[model samples]
Target: MDLFNSAQGKNISFVRPAYFIIGGFIGMAHVKFYFVFLFFVYVVSVLGNTIVMLVIYLDHNLRTPKYIAVFNLAFVDLFGNSALVPKILDTFLFNHHSISYNDCLTYMFFCYTCLSMQALNLVALAYDRLVAILFPLHYMVKVTHRFMLTMICSFWAFIIIAVLIAVGLITRLSFCKSVLINSYFCDHGQVYRLACNDYFPNDMVSYMYPVFIFWLPLAFILISYLYICGTLAKVATVQEGLKAFKTCIGHLSLVAIYFIPLLIVFTLMEKIHPNARIINLSLTSIFPPMLNPIIYVLQTQEIKESVKRLLKMDRKLQLKRIAIM
Candidate 1:
């Protein structure tokens, strides 16, 4: 393969490989058991998220701005898990480790886009809570259906474009060296680092992507909650403050579930074993999708009631059908 790309007029060569070997749980002890657990998680995630979305769709009471963010979160979770877990099973469990270069980039695009949106969706939920508690009187006006939809759509658009740019940068890289990806999937960092040519652009993106996806969204959520706390403190009674805080329990649980594991894993990356790091990263990615809907269903009264109402309506419909028959 040619080492230099004379077409660039910079003596840089592009040696793109046909396929990259994914080092997913290879040589790991009892890894199949983990994959089985991941399969169970994926199945529950699909069912739970689908049910959440269905409830929000069917229940007119849930057709509010708040549920818009809820619905979006469920969708993002479902999409994110679908993009990740299935591919992991196929690649590692089935021993189909060699993925085409373009396919790898495509995989990274979907996984990262959904992951980014998951964090931003939490930000949307936090914004909803912030407006609800801090400006209760004007909550409806501030968090209208149109406004919520626009916010979620804008997030989707921005994340899609940002992830696309990241994937595009990988095309410029020449992976003349080892094409073995150390992580589970076609991780952007692991893939780009294998490039024989300069990957400065990819490296810059690696740092910036986390800030946008993790740090900024987390900072926004924290600041919003701080403002919420300040507002609640001014309320006339302790009970009133507690009630307002109660509304945030579901969102808080979600925020913690989604962000805490990621923060811990990244902070402790250097000290952890590579296999352990990969497992933690994989868990952090898959667990949130499975847990998000469960948290909302259990911690959020509104969703719980919606689910109950949906079940009752379905039961009534079935009884009426039997009566007619």
Candidate 2:
């Protein structure tokens, strides 16, 4: 309390709390089952994303510019889930609801950063598909490994800075009122609204952050697909156009998985029950990481064949070792 009271400004003194209570899952019936499901989702997400990354790393055939985005997506998904799910379980399931002020901000930073990257990563994949489908002749020259790495790295740098700014704005707030954040995690909007001081900056960020992370990325992806469609229309035959478009199915599935639930929940947020909304939001956060690898492995022939070849090699080694025994 003494430490927080020392933060004095021109005229106004700030009242910062030592900790905030997370009551997102409190007083909800059958919440334990949701935690169990989350555990299952986390386990599968870890295994699936790990496999995808390992396959991409071990198979030289999978090291194309396209797979670079895929590899990064897997890494982001793994890191995102690792950042969110465990803390959620510990907070709600194990009854560790009180989060220190600094820890809550750190939690918010990682969760928001990873969540923002998920959207921007889709933009990277969309760019890869756009160039590959629209400009096949120049795809090699345009979408080199170095170019893809640069794009992904640029996204990382931009999003880290942006999220840091958002988190930084939260520090300017003075939570003199109730420190109970009503969300599942340390949500940005929930945390700032509890402040007694001027939170107009935080409120502005609440509006702008969604535009950068959600709307802009979705717009880019839609426009890219429109361009892809326009190009495919001039193909020699219907089958050729279909064949070209088939390559985008995995990416399309990913976009749908990532965006659709959030869209629905946000669109109907006022009408939905608070607990239901929280559950839906939690699902939106956790499901994509679990589903992304499955979609890619099943939809992309390259990844499927890589998995097959690796499995066959492993089986052969086992057979040889058994024969030796």
Assess candidate 1 and give its lDDT.
0.91
Alpha-carbon runs more than 4 Å astray in model 2? 1-12, 322-325
- List pairs with backbone clashes in candidate 1: 4-13, 5-12, 5-13
* TM per candidate: 0.95, 0.96
Q: For candidate 1, which ten residues in a row score worst on lDDT?
A: 1-10
TM-score: model 2 vs. ground truth: 0.96
State the lDDT of candidate 2 residue by residue for 1-325, as single tens digits.
4324435576777777788999999999999999999999999999999999999999999989999999999999999999999999999999999988899999999999998999999999999999999889999999999999999999999999999999999988887668889899999988999988888989998999889999999999999999999988876478998998999999999999999998899799999999998899999999999999999999999999999999999999999999999
| Candidate 1, superposed: residue stretches over 4 Å from native | 1-12
Residue-wise lDDT of candidate 1 within 75-116, one digit each (tens)?
A: 999999999999999999989999887899999999999988
Note the Cα lDDT for every prediction shown: 0.91, 0.93
